[model samples]
Structures are given as structure tokens and as C-alpha cells.
Target: MEGLYIEPTETSPKVHFDPEAFSFEISGESRPEDVRKFYKPVLDWFEQYSNYLYWLTEKYAEGEKKLVQFHFVFEYFNSSSAKYIMDVIAKLGDIQKASPNAKIQILWHYDEPDEDMKEAGEEFETITNIPFKYIINPD
Candidate 1:
């Protein structure tokens, strides 16, 4: 199945989800004027991806496990964006729950001295019960 990619804007983030490469990332500031409209497609892509993952698991029961990396790098985001961000993570959590053979790694990248971002990642880790690898970026 094909993946999803969206260019970033001043008040939005860049989203790149490559299924074949098993790499996904959402980066940049997010405060889109219409939060729901901006995030709806992203959420939809994950639903489709979930279905695709299901097919792969059913078809390749004996195949090797798949390792998928999801990176969340945000410089800033508003509360509305945060809600959709959590929704995205929830979708991922759902994927993880449904597919045991697929290893989903969540990587949270934050700039140096940004304790809020780090703490946000930690909160998500706790809420979703999904492990996250925190990467500190130089300011």
C-alpha cells in the first residue's frame, strides 16, 4: 500500500509516512487555522494503514517481523493541534495492539532545554502505554 506525505506550512507540520521504508515522521510547528481539516487526512491515512497492516499480517504469518519507526518532531503546537496529535498516537497505539508481529517504535524529538516537549512525550508514553525514545536536538 502507498503512504502519505504532506508539505509543511508556517502553521502546520510536515508529515511523511512511508510504509515501504517503514519510516514515518511529523515535524515542524503546528497551529493550523482549521485544526480538524488539517488533521483529518492524517488520521484517515492511518486507518488505511491499519487495514493494510492487517492484510500483511494475515498473508505473511511466517514472514519476519516488521519494524516501523514513527518520529514526532515539533517546535511548537497549539492545544487544538495537541488533541489531533494524541489522536494520531491513539491510532498508532491501535495498530500496535492489533499487530504483534509489527514493531512500532515511537521517537520523540525535541530541541535542547525544551522540558515541556520532553514531558509531553513522557505523558503520551504513559497514557498510551507505548515506549518512546526521546532524542534531544541542539537548539
Candidate 2:
């Protein structure tokens, strides 16, 4: 599959989901007035990607986990966006559970000056079934 790429807007983040590379990334700020409308395509892409990987793992690559590496680098986001983020992670968890040779690693990025962002990542880790890596970036 090609991938879903969305340019960053003032109230939303940039999304890049590459199914071929098995990598996905969302960065920038997210606080869309209508969160559902903004994130529906993203959630849909995740679902399709999950199904594709599930098929690939079953038919082609057997014994290979770690099917995806997802990166989340948000400079800022509203409470509503937080809820959507959790849903995205949950979708990934579901994908992992459904595919026997499926694994996902989430990397949460935050700059040194943003302790709140760092804390947000830490808090999300506690609630998610997927493994996460907290990255302290100076950017």
C-alpha cells in the first residue's frame, strides 16, 4: 500500500503512515475543533494497515514479529486529541492481539523544556498494552 500522508494544519498534526516500510509517524500539534473528522482517516488507515500486515504475516513472513514502528511526536495537543490518541493506541493493541507474528513499538517524543509533554507520554505508557519508548529530545 502507498500510505496516508496528511500535511500539518494549525489545529492538527502531520500524519505519515507507510505500510510498505512498516513505519508510521505523527508529529506537530493536534487540537482540531472536530477531532473525529480529523482522525477518522487515520484510524481507517491503521485498520487497513493492520489487516494487510495480518495477511502478510500469515502467508509470506511467518516467524517475524515487530511488524510496525510507530512514532508520536506532538509539541502540543488538547484533551480531545488525547482521547483519540488513546484510541489509536488501542487499535494497535488489537492488531497485535489478532496477528500472531505482529508486534508494535511506539516511540513518544518530547523536548527537554516540555515536562508536561514528557509526563503525558509517561502517563499514556501506563494505560497502553503496546510497549513504548520515551525519547527526550532537545528539539
Candidate 3:
């Protein structure tokens, strides 16, 4: 299955979802003028990816769990983007729940001293019930 990749812009984030490498990342700012338009494709991609993962798990890795890493490295984002971010995380949680052979690791990256960012990650963890490994980026 093909993955999705979107370059970051002044008002949007970078999205890189590579199934072959089993790597995913969403970084940079996210406050696009059309939030829905910007995130709709992302949400759709996740839905399809979830299905693909399910199939792959059942067919190939029957007894083994495949580790998938999702990285989030945002410098800033607005309220509008937060809702979609939550949706993305929820979808991931759903994927994990549906696929017993799939394991997801959410890596939330933030610069040291960004309390608000850290708090946001905490809030996401609390709401989604998905444990996130917090990584402090160096200057």
C-alpha cells in the first residue's frame, strides 16, 4: 500500500507516512486557513492505512506484533488544528485496538521549556488513553 507525504508550509504541518519503512511523522506549524481541507486527506489516509495494517497483520504477522512509530514534532499549532490532531491520535488508538498484531508507539517531541507543548501531549495522552513517549529536543 502506498503512503502519504505532504510538505510543510507556512500555515500547515509536514506529514510523512511511509508504510514501507514503517515510519510516520507530522511536524511543523499547523494553522492553515482551511483547516478541514488541509486535514481531510490526512484523516482519510489514516483510515485506509488502518485497514491495510489489519490485513497485513492477519496475513503475514499472525503471532508477531508489528511496531509502528508515529512521531509528532510541532513547534506550534492553533485550536482548530488541535481537534484534528486528536482525531488522528484517536484513529491510531482505534487501529491498535482493532489489530491485535499491531503495536503503535506515539513519540511526542517538543523543545525543552515548552511547557504548553508538553501539556498538550499530556492532554492527548489522557484523552486518547495512548501512552506517548515524550522526547525533549535540544537547541
Q: After superposition, how far is residue 105 of candidate 1 from its true place, in Å?
A: 1.0
Tens-digit lDDT string for candidate 3 (1-139): 9989999999999999999899899999999999999999999998899889998887654568898999999999999999999999999999999887888999999999998999999999999999999999979
Clashing pairs in 1: none
Residue range 9-121, candidate 1, lDDT tens digits: 99999999898877799999999999999999999999899878877765556766788889999999998888888888988999988887788899999988999999998
By descending TM-score, how would the candidates be arranged?
A: 3, 1, 2
Each candidate's TM vs. the true structure? 0.92, 0.90, 0.95
**Error at 13, model 2, angstroms:** 0.3
Using TM-score as the measure, name the better of candidate 1 and candidate 2. 1
TM-score of 2: 0.90
Q: For candidate 3, give the lDDT.
A: 0.94
User: Candidate 2, residues 1-139: lDDT per residue as tens digits?
Assistant: 7699999999999998888776689999999999999999989888887778888777646575654678999999999999899888888888878777766778999998899998888778778856788888764
Candidate 3 runs further than 4 Å off? 60-63
The prediction achieving the highest lDDT against the true structure is 3
Question: Can you tell me which runs of candidate 1 are displaced by over 4 Å?
Answer: 59-63
| Candidate order, lDDT descending | 3, 1, 2
Give the C-alpha lDDT of model 2.
0.85
Q: Higher-TM-score candidate among 2 and 3?
A: 3
